[model samples]
Target: MFTGLIENLGVIDSFESDRFTLSVLNTSTTSILSTASVGDSIAVDGVCLTVESFTDNSFTVTVSPETLQRTTLSEKIKTTNYVNLESSLCVGSKLGGHFVTGHVDGIGSLVNYISTNKAWEMTFAAPSSKIQEWSNFIEPYLITKGSIAVNGISLTIAECDVSGNWFKVSVIPHTYAYTNLHYLRPGDLVNIEGDILGKYVEKFLSSTLKSTKDRQSNINSDFLAEQGYQ
Candidate 1:
């Protein structure tokens, strides 16, 4: 699990087939490499990748086929050289952001971005080519004002359409300058993870409703009246 708070930025040193090597950009501060060890999990662009090997400044991970299909990691290798990185949450660490599983649901793209006086309002939408995947995995959980992890950066939905086709987030200057969001452009792909709580609630409610519909109740109004004095 993670808090979706980005710790450092990493440059993609090399990506070939399933193996990826990323060099930490800022090692002076608390970085993923500082405590990284083989078999440790790290959030790379919101995807939880296991550390297969590491050095003082760089680490390597192998991407599974499922992760590649669900996230933008493969696309990122071609389009962007930098990736947002965050270490897994420790037991006693402060929960600065929302609970992020680092399990990306699907990929979204930057629709547009505008600079406001205080923040940068960035709009994102599901790519037309991957509309089905977006609808199935991402669209259902896009609640206005709800938490979401975009490229591993935790953010709230500033606004969203009723149909859930698109959503926007207000990024403060600090986050914009510190993370990889500053490098994004229109049509750039990003990994997206919806609030895990919302997904759990949906699953529970759906299952409960389904079970209620399938079960035959023994007590109707007639039966209740017969059993009770009232």
Candidate 2:
């Protein structure tokens, strides 16, 4: 698990098929590699990746086909070399941000961005070509004022439509300057992970409703006997 608080920015050094190497740019106060070790899980652009090997400034991880299909890593590597990095949460570490699983649901693209006096308001939505995928995996969980992890940066939904077609986040100056969000342009792809708590609640509610409806529809003497009702 992660807190969606970006620790460092990394530059994609090389990507050969599945092997990926990232050079950590320790621009932040904390360094991801300082306490990292082989097999450690790191959130790379909101995708949980394992450290296969490491050095003082760089580390390698293998990207599986599923990760590639579900995230923007492949497109990000081609369009930009920068990515947000965050190490997995330690037991006693302060929970600075919302709970982030580092499991990207699907890819979204920057719809637009505007600079406000105090923050940068950025809007994101499903790419036109992949709206179905976004609807299935992402849209259901988006709620106004809810927490979301975009490219592994914890942010709250400043605004969103009831349909969940798009959402906007207000990024403060510190986050804009520190993370890879500064490099994004309109239509740039980003990895998106909805709040884990919301997903669990949705699952529980769905299952409960389904079971209730099934029991109601199957109401009969035989069903009562099976359920051990006298």
Candidate 3:
């Protein structure tokens, strides 16, 4: 799990068919290398990647075909790019952001950006059909005032409508200056991991309801009494 709060912006030193290499390219970055170890989970642009090895200021992880199909990792490698990085959340740590699983639900592209007196507003255009179709899997967790992780950054959903199947987020100057969001441009793809709590709640409700419906007798007091219901 993660808080969607980016700890550092790492640069892609190199990428291959299965292996990826990243290094601390930002001098102002404060993420500690000593605190990391092999086998630990890290969020690389919202996609959970396990650290396979480390040397110097760089680390490596192998990407699976499924992850490549679901995230911007492949696109980034083809374009030779930098990526946002965050370590996993630990107990007793400050919850700076919303709960993020580092699991990309879908890929979205930057549509536009504008500067506002309060904050920078950005819109991302994704496959409307997919987001709406997956609403059953994601909507219950999304409250009007709840949170979501966009490219590993915790952001609030200013507005979400079914008609456009799109959402918008506002970024303060600090987030814009400290993260890779500033690098986003029209048509640039990003990895999106919806709030984790919502996913679990959706699953639990669906399972319980489905099971109760399937076992119709399990719902009646008479049937429950046969099983020692009090």
Candidate 4:
């Protein structure tokens, strides 16, 4: 689990097949190397990846084929890209941001960016979420003023289309400058994770409704026996 708060900006070192290596650019290398161990989970751009190896300045993780198909990491690997990094949440620490699972649901495209006097209002167009898939579940939980994790940065949805495929977020200058959002361009893809709480509620409601419908339509032998019905 994570808090959606970025801890460091890492320079993409190399992506050779399954090996994804990154080096600390602005953050302290010695501190990270000393603390982080192999098998520790790290969130790279909202994707939870396990640390396979590390050095004073760089670390490597193995990316699964599923991750490559679901996230923007494959694209990030093509060029020299800076990715947002956040360590797993520690117990007893302040929850600065909403609970983030570092599980990318799917990819979203930046549609537009408008600079307001106080913040940056950005619009994104997520793919249609008719079924449950990463990047395909946004519609169920894309609520206005609800939390979302985009590229591992926690943000609140300022507005959302009723269809749920498009949404807007308000980004303060501090958030824009500190994280990788500053490097974003229109049409660029980003990893997205909706609020977990919303997902849970959606699942619960769906299950309850389905169960009710099934019970109404089908006769259950156990239920009939309990009710003394032949």
Candidate 5:
């Protein structure tokens, strides 16, 4: 679990078929390498990648094909300079942002970005159809004021299209300057993870209702007579 608060910027040193290495590129927060150890979970662009090995200024993780297919990590290897990095939430740590599982549901793209006095209004076009190439899951449950993670950065939805094709977020200057969102272009794809809480609730309710209907007992006249209720 993570709070979606970016801790540092990691410059990708190398990306291969299964391995990804990055340096401890920090801007404001404490460098993760200061305390991170092997097997520690790190959110690299919204995907929870376990640290396979490390050095004073660098760390590595072995990525799976499924993760590569679902996140922007592969696309970013050829484009993005720095990737957003965040440490997992601790027991007593501050929860500045929403709960981010670091599980990328699908990839979305930037539709537009505009500067505003209050905040930078940024819009993203979500994947509409299930692209089997990816995890093939694009269920947008984002409500107005609900939280969403884009490239591992938790943000609140400002305006979402009813069709779930796109949504907007108002990012403050601090957030914009610190994370990899600054490196995004209009068409750049981002790792997207919907709020886990909402997803679970939706699943629970749907399953509960389905099971209830499946187990419905029909009380016909013949059944009532057999039960001595006629």
Candidate 6:
């Protein structure tokens, strides 16, 4: 699991079919490489990818067909791109951000970005035509005032509309300057992972509760049979 806390900004060095070569830039270079290794999982722009190879300055990983279909990685690679990279969390480390599974639900287009003295308020539009397919990742994860991981950076869901396929997030200047979020354009695609906790809660409430209810009903039926009631 990841914390949606970006540790390094890695550039796309090269791409060959489904495989991508990345080079870590900036001062975190050594620290970022230290914890990383072949076969280790890393979140690249909120998409959990396994390292296939690595060196002091660079690494390579293969993107699965499902990943390509669900995330913005394929879109970002059409040109040179910088991705937010975060290594998997270690035991005892502070949970700086919410639980992020590095699982991209679907892609969204950045519709607008407004800069103010305080922060950057950005709006995104999920495809409206295919509501279910477009919002599948976010629908389960969104809660008012709760956290969501966008491009591997954890941010709270400031607001969402019940019917509209759009939401807004307010980004502080520090996050904008440190992460690749600053390089985002109005039309850029983003890999979004809804909060992990929300997903688990939903699963438990939906499946586990149903199972418990069914078992209780069966028990009640057995009790009635023992009492000679049909």
Every candidate's CA RMSD: 2.9, 3.9, 5.0, 4.5, 2.7, 3.5
CA lDDT, candidate 5, residue 190: 84
TM-scores of the candidates are 0.92, 0.93, 0.84, 0.88, 0.89, 0.86
Comparison by lDDT, 4 against 5, better one: 4
Residue 196 accuracy (lDDT) in model 6: 73
- Decoy 4 TM-score against native: 0.88
- Of the candidates numbered 1 and 4, which has the greater lDDT value? 1
Q: How close is candidate 6 to the true structure, as a TM-score?
A: 0.86
lDDT of 4 by residue, 1-230 (tens): 99988878887888888998899766533334557989998899999999998987789999999999889899898878789888888899889999999888888889899999999999988644323553357777899999999999999999998878689999999889878898989988899999999999999999999998877745589889889997
lDDT of 5 by residue, 1-230 (tens): 99989999888888877998898775864788888988899999889999999998899999999888767788767863788898888899999999999988888878799988868899987544434422335444767899999889989999887766678999999999999898887977888888898888888998999999899687888899999995
Q: What's the distance in Å from true for residue 221, model 3?
A: 20
Better of 1 and 6 by lDDT: 1
Pairs that collide, model 3: none
Clashes of each: 0, 0, 0, 4, 0, 0
lDDT of each: 0.91, 0.92, 0.79, 0.86, 0.84, 0.82
**Mind sharing the TM-score for model 1?**
0.92
Pairs in clash, predicted candidate 5: none
lDDT of model 1, residue 87: 93
lDDT of 1 at 4: 88
Please state the error at residue 69 of candidate 4 in Å.
Answer: 0.5
Model 4 spans with C-alpha error above 4 angstroms: 27-34, 127-135, 217-230
In model 2, which regions exceed 4 Å deviation?
A: 217-230
- The C-alpha local distance difference test score for the whole of candidate 5 amounts to 0.84
